[model samples]
Target: MKEYEQNQQKNKEHYEKVYANYNLNNILYWLNNLEGYLDFVTNYETSWSALYQNDFRNRIKGKKVLEMGCGDCNNAAIMAALGARVYANDIASTSGKIVEQLNGSFDFSHPIVFVEGDFLNNDLASGSFDFVIGKAFLHHLSLPVEREFLKETARLLKTDGEARFFEPAVNSKLLDELRWYIPIGNRPSKFRGEAFRKWKEEDPHPDRSFSSAHFKKAVNEFFEECLIKPVGTLDRFRNLIKNRKWNGRYAKWALKNEQKLPLFLNSKFARSQLIVGKLPLK
Candidate 1:
């Protein structure tokens, strides 16, 4: 418990520093423009559109939705627009303020309730929400805490409710080995050594990546039925071509076709996984 409390404080301070510099005005601009919104979704959160956009529009209408670690409240805003009563939670106070600002800017049918606190200890009522979702949230926890978090998620959901998440995955041993050889500045991806080191310095909890097997083990321990889909089999290749003139075309093609790749290939090499699970019907 002592370690957990320390970790919580560390995470809170880290995110406070991170969100202090966030660009709410820029995000608001994107939210106001249709093409820009689409671009933002495609570039930063493609999995949302690919995995849950249709379901959110179709099944989430008039349902109660809870989003943990809702950074910037983008997904929560979308859920509210789709007619779900949304509760968005994050450790950073800035996130709550940002959500409030978004609420003021947009005419959403249902207003989003923003809660700023540790999610595990928040004052939200249990067995009340119809759906629980998070993106890149679970990976921030240590394995034991992640298991506890999943159990808490079960406790918070309606008997018939469901949970979904989009998380980073470590699928390829070859790529993992190669990553060590790439220098921080020369690395192809945006998350480099300096930024990672800074994050670690602020937070004691291990924000580790997951493999398909790791995700499955954790989900199965809490839920009886689940589906895990690996995505972005060609993301490294796409990253290689990201800055070239044909980057847009290549990204479009990759996004369209990556999921269609064979299950084995995706499981071994995809950059992330989308996990969907439901509580066992008692």
Candidate 2:
């Protein structure tokens, strides 16, 4: 195993904390550098969530679904709403319960299962899901770890099944650097919020942040058909511009006339990347 893979495996609890639990993730994420936090949120809403209603949910009707990182599985709820047999998993029990409460609220009649476990070592049978989704999940993997997980996803996905993924890219140096400062925006800033009194810390590995090109390469290594597009970062940028306290007016104008940006840092670079691929039929 490469050093990073070893490092990741050695820090099993750490990865679980970072990628597994949604509630703690919020606190840990708030502790990340401002730019890193910004990029993370942008990717979460746009890239990972790109499939929310229009794309993945619509396709899930009458299907069996497994959602990786099903933390607060809003998408899973949607799938159940569409008559899917949805199975959602996450390392974060708190968020799993949140998904439960949420589904209960909106889907009292639909059937959905929410499980909490370390997916890498969880004893789920191979080829269990008709479709496997890792929305906002794989970005937590380094390149090598991503490869391992992709292989695992391939193992779990049925011969004709698909695995979809979404993650923020450390694509542009300029934008990546700017990500550290993007506040969570739904509430007060983490740094400026209650965390100021609870913990004094920062992300241990900032260099591991990712970009779409890298994610696309990882997907191609295992899945036969991969589609990746920039979708989230643009929305976050939209949020940054539109928030009442931030640059909302400017964001409205920029979005209204978004074509003014230059060629290199066009809208794509400013968005999150989405990918979908199928296991080889062998």
Candidate 3:
């Protein structure tokens, strides 16, 4: 079987396990699906709130933003609040609920639409967005598809448009050793607990870290400058101090400020990687 089909099958099997367990329930699933999303009018309002106060709004504001693979609209909501015309698309049905919540929360909602489709094959208008954003989406593809993903992103962007991307960067050595006995798969991102629980048995690739290198090279090939930034030490160490469901940790966002501590100094091995790339201005 082809690798993409195989990954899809494993993902399907994993979801089946998740649904069968169901003890975790949909609300948790919804929240977990939010990944970097903090709850406002919902779960962890503090987490969501801090993200906005920091550097998020300052970054992608006042642009026509397209959040590709946006499952829950949290990132889209952030951009929308910053006065961007935000558009999002995902293959899940729950995406509708996310847009509804976003519409209810914000006062000055710019144009926002959520469509359901495969991003790889979907025929979106070329150069539709000034900015395209995806959180933890690209590494899901194998190599050739990764190349195509960049080409597609380039096609969709106008000459000077940008793509804001967040991906999981690996430690390489640590994960490579584990791949020998473990049936290594291409990736283990997105709700890593669930990824481990789901595709744990099927892993096979040993030396593969599936970092943002592919994203950098892919984007750099088309766009002028590709910057890969890292985030999430706060999400990591702070989770130990306070559980959001009970005692919400104010320190989660604090841990990521590399200007303070050396822990977050490097992009690789950080909890997540963010790449902001753009086509050269003419």
TM-scores, each model vs. reference: 0.85, 0.67, 0.65
Which tens-of-lDDT digit does each residue in 132-214 have in candidate 3? 77776666666676667677787787787877676666545564344333332345544466666565456422223456666
Q: Lowest summed-lDDT stretch of 10 residues in model 2?
A: 197-206
| Per-residue accuracy of model 2 over 1-282 as CA lDDT, tens digit each | 566644454344454565444443443333334345433433333442355424554576777788887755655655565578888876666556666555545533456787666566667778777888777777655666677778878878788888877666556787664554456533334456465323223332324656666766777788777776555333456654555645544443443343455645543475555577776333
lDDT score at residue 176, model 2, on the 0-100 scale: 64
Rank all candidate structures by their lDDT, best first, as comma-separated numbers.
Answer: 1, 2, 3
Q: What is the lDDT of residue 103 in candidate 3?
A: 66
**Best model per lDDT:** 1
Output the number of the TM-score-best candidate: 1
- TM-score for model 3? 0.65
Clashing pairs in 3: 183-203, 183-204, 184-203, 184-204, 184-205, 185-204
